[model samples]
Target: MRESRAKSVWLQREPSPAAAARVFCVPHAGCGTGVFRNWPPEHGPVDFLPVELPGRLSRFGETMPATFEELAADMIAGLERYMDVPFAFFGHCWSALLAYEATARLQRAGGPAAARLFVSSQLAPQDGPVGRMLGMDEAELAGELEAMIRDQGGTPHPELVAVYLRVLRADVEMSRRYVVPDPLRLTCPITAIGWSEDSEVRPGQMSGWPACGDTSFEVFAGRHNRFVDAPRELLTTLCAGMAGRGPSRLPVTSR
Candidate 1:
């Protein structure tokens, strides 16, 4: 079942009597749980719960996060419950940085850390956000936003487009202002996913991930926003990590 409390949105739809591991999904900036709306609540034995950040969608009245670190900190308290059992995190694009920081914060607090960290359609946490979205003006950004919405097969009216733009601008600004801190080693594995046709982040740009943990790279078929649709390959990749305890018995982050 899905629950929207003060800090985060837990999008688990399963009412299974017995629970297994869970996968907490974090959306890219300006996006919401709507991205994973079509994904099943249970992928095999694991449950899927997508995290809805504050100030977006149902949390529209909340303040937008100032930094990746700050956002992660805000969500940690609410995320504590899922940690009672084995759980991991899945983040795409901007959420990759947020997830990494959140995982780190969890480790620093000596809390139940995530089983794994799956990052898709993005570069390493140290690589940061780089793209045409960085310098685009209002007109260019508007066009880009419309193109993205249309690519996802949605026809957006001008008024609705403006509403999205307001959030998009703030999200992009956060990305621009972000600076990846010195890398800290984490016990959990880090998987960086790339798309062969993705124009935003390429395979070569996905290096430097080992700074975070024992890292691996996987390539799937699609574009930058592919994860928004929750493709099969992406779900399968995530399900692989969700199945059981990885090489590390307990994941941690070291300063």
Candidate 2:
């Protein structure tokens, strides 16, 4: 993979001539690809590509995507130029859903299909709208953020938290306005990973991933934002699952 920034996309790459696989990661809402900075380097032997959407980090001035379809389309168009290699996708939260749609679209367009899709810390695609947080005014949004921190168990550094809250507001607005244009289904075998304490996503919602495609679901023992809170364990489990077959743990059933 290579580093480039297009209309509304920011791309980062970890190149290796010996790399047998490439993983494209779509970050959670408000998060830049920076979140995966250490992933590629640490989990060697494969190339890692982190995708940056508009309105975050380097692409700060660009308009945030309003709907899921538009976001997926933008990603496909922006990154299709670099699709020569076999690849996979790892996405968190809303990005998981976005990645799923984009991959499905790519297959439909006769583009090369990815080897696997690792969706983490997100509700299943078939779950009813998971309720958006942007409808609240700034004050209400702050309160919601506090509640999220309490429920999710990880708070950014104090200074970082302040900046992230503003970014979070924009993310919420984008997520709130998002509408899916087609059936929320995928043909790829999607592995769904979520936090055990994530109240925002229920067991039923996680189990609904099968409705999206051939899926395997598992719950990590942590809060909603487990990716940030628990890095090594999460990444290792995620990469191992994607690189091989089956989840790190036994498949989960809906509660």
The most accurate candidate by lDDT is 1
lDDT of each: 0.74, 0.67
Candidate 1 ranges beyond 4 A from true positions = 1-17, 244-255
Error of 2 at 166 (Å): 6.0
Q: Kindly list the per-residue Cα lDDT of model 2 for residues 148-228, writing each as its tens digit.
A: 555454564556556667777767765655545344466667777877777666544666666666777766777666565
Per-residue error (Å), model 2, residue 8: 11
lDDT of 1 by residue, 1-255 (tens): 755333435443433435577788887766677778778877877778888677778777788777777778878876785576778888888788778888888888888878888877666666666767888888887887788768667787898678878888888888887777677788888877878777777766777677889876777788788776778877777777776432232221211
Model 1: ten consecutive residues of lowest lDDT: 246-255
> In the order shown, what is each candidate's alpha-carbon RMSD?
5.2, 4.3
